[model samples]
Target: MPSETVVLLPGTASDEVFVRTVFAEPLSQVGAVLVAPRVRTLCERLTALDNASAGHPIVVGGVSLGAHVAALWAVRNPDRCAGLVLALPAWTGAADGAPAALAAKASARVVADRGLDAALAGTTGWLHDELTRAWHGYGDELVPHFEEAAESVAPTLDELRSLTVPAGIVGCTDDPVHPVDVARKWAEAIPGAVLTTTTLDAYPRALGDAVQAWQRAKG
Candidate 1:
């Protein structure tokens, strides 16, 4: 049997480095062609994946806005997707009041008004480093993606219930930005979907583990 191709996406304002660093190892165990595109809009990301997959069945996954986009795409192209791995899902349908969305909106505002340097300075603590590392790699173009991604919504509960591919949902238990409840809701809605609740302190290793297991089992 042929190996499945995997297109892992990064969160808002993040570049290929983030997703590649988090997923490259385990996904290699599956002998997958891992493509991480540097796109801002949902349509762009999906279109990039569509081109990268080269008509080969693939496992699609992403973090935050990326995760939301992956789920939405999987639903629209079930046969094209072999599996899904959603990490730190921001919100279900509308991104209204969601912590991640609000933060993205605020960052976009700062970037648009004060500029990227000021926006980077506004972040504090571990987030300061995390945001700086990803945002720096992206430069100014990432700002628009932050705003657009925050406004983008994933599939609804009804749509999730109709998903055919196996899904692996991971959420940070203590992260207000990406609620664990949202992950649980997705797991419940998608038949045979597995959910894992992790923490920010642990980084996204749990997400990688969950995806690896899902691929092994779902295969």
Candidate 2:
């Protein structure tokens, strides 16, 4: 059988380098060609995947905004996507007013008003903790990419409710941005979706485990 393709979509203010570094090795074990696209819009990203894969069935996954995008795409292209792997998906509506949104908005405003340097100084620590320092060692190279990514996508709640693909939502109990309850809600909404919770520090490990489990269930 042909190996399944796994598309990795990075969260808001993230780049391909960071997402690739986190999932490349572990996910590769499933013999999946990991495609980490740099696009921001959900439709454009999914279109890119469709054009690249040429109708091959795929597993779609992403972090934060990326996760939201993946979920939206999987629902829209249910026949093309085999499943979903969502990490730290941002909540919409009432869930948006949570601490995570306030912090993200504040950070975005600072970057838009002050500059990347100032915004990075204040927000880097938060992102580092959430992503387990995946982009920390890359220095300035990752910052501009992140800023560009953030500018590419905006939040849309309607898209969130339409997801239908079987999904695995990986969330952190301690993450203010991706509350465990919100993740659970995503799983509950999607038919046969599963919500798995882990600590912020164990993100990579939890993601790897969830991917493996999802793949096994598919077989």
Candidate 3:
């Protein structure tokens, strides 16, 4: 791996704290100069990456919505891509009917009609906590972002097939939203990409292990 620059983006309703759980300390120990930039919209993420990559190519990847955005970035900017690490991709193309998108749409409605606090209180489980943390931190723009993300289109299958950078992908067998099959297809599409699967609870570890394995194979 040597010394490399890696920036892993967070998923929708996710923050830097959450993203770091998957790729910070471990990668830093492995000599990766990490830069986890916080950008709100998909456009912002791409712009930030472009700005950050002015002088050097860097490894870029993310989870769920972030993964969707990162995939497109890699396909469009192959020359600036050192590697990729897509994890838990939600869908390909415009996933209007995707449960994750539907859920976001519905949540956006709740937040819009009621309010962030009201909607947050009504929601339950780990998702509830995650949304609370992410949305609240997002401030008033959260609802609109959620609404927009709900209908966001993914990079076409052709885009995925066109990526040639070294890639390491991870998926959770227990996560229905980020289907393991989609992850498998992504791995198969990207040239020489490696795939790793684990339970939802073990995804962070799986991602670390997968990246290490890919680096070993590359070496």
- Compared with the true structure, all predictions reach lDDT values of 0.79, 0.64, 0.78
Of candidates 2 and 1, the better by TM-score: 1
Best by lDDT: 1
True-structure lDDT of candidate 1: 0.79
Name the Cα RMSD for model 1: 2.1
Inter-residue clash pairs, candidate 3: none
Q: Write out the backbone clash pairs for model 2.
A: none
What lDDT tens digits, residue by residue, belong to model 1 across residues 1-219?
677777888888876777877788877877766778877667788887688656677888888878888888888888788888778877889887888889888988888888888988766775687778888776757777777877888789998998888777777788877788988898899888878778878875666765764664475
Runs of candidate 3 with Cα error greater than 4 angstroms are 122-128, 203-210, 213-219
Ranking the candidates on lDDT from highest down gives: 1, 3, 2
TM-score of each: 0.90, 0.75, 0.90
Between candidates 1 and 2, which one is better according to lDDT? Answer: 1
* lDDT (Cα, tens digit) per residue for candidate 2, span 83-151: 777777667434335555555566656655775567656444546564334344334444454444444
- lDDT score at residue 30, model 1, on the 0-100 scale: 70
Each model's RMSD to truth, in Å? 2.1, 4.6, 2.2
